[model samples]
Structure formats: C-alpha cells, structure tokens
Target: MASHRKTRQHPKALKAMTLALAGAAGATAFDGTGQAAPHPTPAQVKGRVDALYQEAEVATQHYNGAREEAGAARAELARLQDEAVRRTQKLNAAKAELGTMAGRQYRSGGVDPTVRLMMSADPQRYLDGATVLERAGSHQANAVAGYARRLGSVRQVRDRARTTAERLERSEAALKRQRVTIVRKLDAAEALLDRLTDEQRRQMSPGAGPAAAPEDPARSGAQAPSSRAARAVSFAYAALGKPYVWGATGPSAFDCSGLTQAAWKSGGVSLPRTTYTQIGSGPRIDRSELAPGDLVFFYSGISHVGLYIGDGKMIHAPHPGAPVRIAPVDEMPFAAATRPA
Candidate 1:
C-alpha cells in the first residue's frame, strides 16, 4: 500500500520539479543573468547627443543669418532712440524760448493740423499755399515709405531675437531631458545588477555619465549692440506738434525728411531731401554719442531722415498714409544709422 501511494504521487512530484526548473530558467533567460534591460555604452549616448547637436547646429546657422540682418536694423533702431532724446530737449527748449502763445503764433503761418483746424474759416483755404500742399504731399509719401521699411525691420529684429532665444532654450531642455532619461535607464539597469553577483555589477557599471555636446555656432556668434551704441541714441522732442506736410521744408510744414532736415537745420545743418542721397553726405558716426543737430539716416540707401535728440526716438515725416509724427527708433526697423553733423 505504501509503495502504491508513492507511485500515485510521482506525477505531482515531477510536475513540481518541472515548474521550479521553468521559473529558474525564466530568471536567467535575459542575455544577462538578471531580469533587466541591457545597459547602453558611452558610444551610444555620444551618438545620440551628437545627432541632437547636429540639429542644433543647423538651427543655429539659420539663426545666425537672421541675426546678422537684425544687427543692421537694430543698429539703426538704436540711432533712432538716440534721436528721440535730442528732439525732446529741442522741443522743450523751443517751448521755453517761445511760450505757448508765441509758439502757436509762429507755427500759424497755418501749418499744423491743430492750428489749421482752428483757423478753418474757409474750407477751400487748403489751396492757399497750393504749391506747399504738393510739398506736403511729397513729404507724406516719403514718410510713409520710410515707416513701412522701418516696420519691416522692427518685425525682423523682434522675430529674430525671439527665435534665437527659443532655439537655445529648447536645445538645452532637450539635452537635459536626454541626460535624465539616460540616468533613469541606468538606474534600472543597476537595480537589476543589485541582485546579481558582484562580478556582474562590475561588468555593467560604466562610471562616466553622458557628456554635454558642443554649443551651436549661431548662438555663439550673435552679439547685441555695445553700450556706446546706447549713448548714440538721441530723440527729437522739438518735432512734437510740428505740422505734417506732404512736402515743405520747414520754416513750417514738413514732409518726413523735411522734418528731420528742418530739425537739424535748427541745430544749424542741412540734410538732403531724399534719404537715399543723404547716405554719402555725412560721416557715419559710431551709433554711440548721437548728438543734437545730428541727422539720423534710415533705409538701406539712407532714404529716410530724423534728428537725433537722444534716447532712441526721432522726429520724422511718418507717412502720407498718416501725418508728420514723432516715432520710436524701433518704429523704422533701421537699416543703417549715420549721423550727418
């Protein structure tokens, strides 16, 4: 009976032994003797990091091209800022030189829109200085042209700066994230070895961690204007409330260049009518130290003009689509800044 009972239990005993063997095999089934993922080599991490760096390089190249263009525009913009300061001082000086009433009377050879509106006794009086109106119209046209160019330049600079910043931030984050993922993977792999023989742990651990890739050249190349550039900023405060003209060089009434030309004239200098011709007429002052009476040039050929008063603003003929205006340096997307003394 005892022998028969042991025979009946033989199948169960065999099944238990088979189950134990299968579990043991499963535990060692991985390429390693542990049930964990494989650890990657330094070469693999380097390969991935290098690929990321390549992408960053291409992005940086694009950034560099854009940055170069922006540099020119921003330089001009800085000049404009400088002009604004000068204009303000001039305007204040003019105000002090001629009190409110006298100033109004002086401008009322009937130029300013505000004064003209006050003296609108004859609606048809617009034809009185008929030739002057034509000049005003021309001034307006030039102002419009200059402003359009400026707007484009500003947008380009703004966009370039924004994109460059984003590129650097995103690349850094990606690199950091990559390192974090590698660390986590390594930890998991290490945990697997924790249950292994000391020999197995030694084989898996590579002491060195992932390295940072080289930075993109584009990010390295772009530099903002120097502090000297900042000082060159002069703004025309005197041009405030000045009458806008299509084209009349002012004793009163101004087109865009006319305003700039006229303002400089107050400082006792004359600038060319069109901004294009003005480019060659003056010495290109380093954008820093823009002085009162200095003519600020705009556009690639210098087709727009403003008087540098100081602090990144300017008084200029804004546009025909608008009126004679005081605008910020950033308004014109300045191509090149030159001050004609």
Candidate 2:
C-alpha cells in the first residue's frame, strides 16, 4: 500500500520531470563533460576568437622562422655530405695505392735490400745502389703515413656530415609541428566565429573590406620624410584591402611583418623576414620620433609590425580575415619602433 504509493507519482509531477530531463539533454555541452553549459555571449566569443587568432599568429611566425632555419640547415647538410664524398674518394685512392705497393713488395720476396747489398759481388757498387733502395723504403713509409692521415680525415668529415644531417632532420620536424599548431589555432578561431550571427560577425570583424579605408588624419596628402620613404608609404597605400595571409610576402596578401618588409622593400630597403629580427634592421626610435615609413612593432614578443604613415596612424595587414587597412598605432599594445632606412 505505502510502497505502491511511493512508486506512483502525480501525473503533473511526472510530466514536469520528463520535460526537465529533455531540456537538459538538449542544451550544449562543453569540454566534453556532457553537462550543459551556458552559451557564451557574442562579446565573450569575440574575446576568445581574438586570443586564438593571436596565438595562431605567434605559431605562424615561429613556423616561418623554423622554415627559414631548416632551409639553411638543409643547404649546409648538402655541402657537408658533398665534402664527405670527396674525402672518402681520396681515402679509397690512398688505400688502393698502399695495396699496390704491398703487392709489389710481396712479389719481390720482401727481402731486405741492405742484406742483398752486403752479399753483392761488387759490395761498394751495391752499397751505392742501397742508398736508392733506402730512399724507396722511406717513400713507402711516407705513403703509409699519408694513407692513415687521409683515413682520419674521411672519418672526421663523415661524422660532421652525419651530425649536420641529424640537425636538419630535427629542424624539419619542428617546422611541421609549428605548422600544425598554427592551423589548429586558426581553425578553432574560425569555428568560434561561425557560431555567431552574421550581424555579430560583421561587427566583430571590422575593416574586413578590401576598399574600405579607415578614417585617418594622415589620409590627406601626407608625404613621407624622404623619397624612399615616400615610395614605401605609397606602396602601403596601394596595398590597401589585401587579405592577411600568415607568412606571406605580397603582391596579393601579407602577414603583419611581411607587409612591413614589402613596404620597406618598395623604398629600396630590405628588412629581415621576422619581427624579432626586423626590429634590429635599423636604428631604434621613440614613439614621438616615428616617421612615415618607420616600422612600428607591437606586443611584448614583437610578433606584429606595421608601416607608419604619419599622424599617429599606420597601415598594416592586421590579422586573418582582415585586409590591409589604416589603423591607429595605439590599436595594439606598442612595444618598440624602428627606422629601417
């Protein structure tokens, strides 16, 4: 009686319980925990997406640097291997010469020339000939010593080439890992962006259009300090609306550092391939001293850069999904500036 009552709930209560369970099951789960979590607001999603983009860029820069190092390492390995081959050939030749000498001596009964001279009929004449024989013996000893030296040299060169080959292999592996990291981060960012409404995405990714220029005080006929600088600045302006492609140096798209490098190149100055090295390409300058065509670096790690076009504004390829456009220098946390030319 009482047990039967306990097993039977009110119809309304049972219905409510069923509805609650269904709602819980339908909500989104996070971290694979299977528990429902609150959906993130657009602002929160934007923050996370931006952080992911920054992370991806950092990885992209690392990948670029690693790729450059791998290239040089591969070239060095090739040179070392070539040297090893040449040294081995010389070693083989030396061994063959020594073998020939040994064969000749064996065929001659390997008798002591000095002993033969002592038993000669004309002992003085044979002794005079013994001097020539002694000279020949000395030459054989020198050949053996030369062979040993060549063998040692071949071993040393081969060892060095093997070590270089190993280093090159390691560098190439690191490059592959970095590339994977960059791709994963970028994909995560894109996924987050996909969750947003179209209007939300548009608001979050401002300056995404190729022809949409940012409003800047420097937009009105601003001239660079020098002719070269002027050319660089002009190149940057012409590059407006180009998409940002990590590790790209452009006629089409570019990364932050690539855009700066290409911009300076237009001005007849060559900059290093990475932000960390590009900072040392020219003299360091204060923020107040920034001029048109000067390279402005951002973030503590100096992973980002732009070309200053005066009035405290810079033209840069901001990041993924954004085009080359004008933005205030203060848009990101400023680290340092350089005058590359």
**Best lDDT goes to which candidate?**
2
Across residues 71-170, which tens digit of lDDT does each residue of candidate 1 receive?
4555655665555555555545533432443356567663445333323465335324333444456543333333333434455555665565565555
Q: What is the C-alpha RMSD of each candidate to the true structure, in Å?
A: 25.4, 9.2
Error of 1 at 334 (Å): 1.0
Report the Cα lDDT for residue 286, model 2: 97
| Prediction 2 global C-alpha lDDT | 0.79
Q: Deviation in angstroms for 191 in model 1?
A: 73
lDDT of 2 by residue, 1-341 (tens): 34555567899999999999877666535443577577788889989997888788778778778877888888988888888889889878976876677667668888344443433687446435545554566765456556556666777788888888888888889889988998899899889988888888877766565644544324645666788887888889888898899889999999988888898898898887888889999889899888888889988888788898887888988878888998889988899999885
Q: What is the lDDT of residue 62 in candidate 2?
A: 83
| Cα lDDT, model 1, residue 255 | 54
Which candidate leads the pack in TM-score?
2
lDDT of 2 at 154: 75
List per-prediction Cα lDDT, in the order shown.
0.47, 0.79
Positional deviation of residue 33's Cα in model 1 after best superposition, in angstroms? 78
The TM-score values for the models, in the order shown, are: 0.29, 0.76
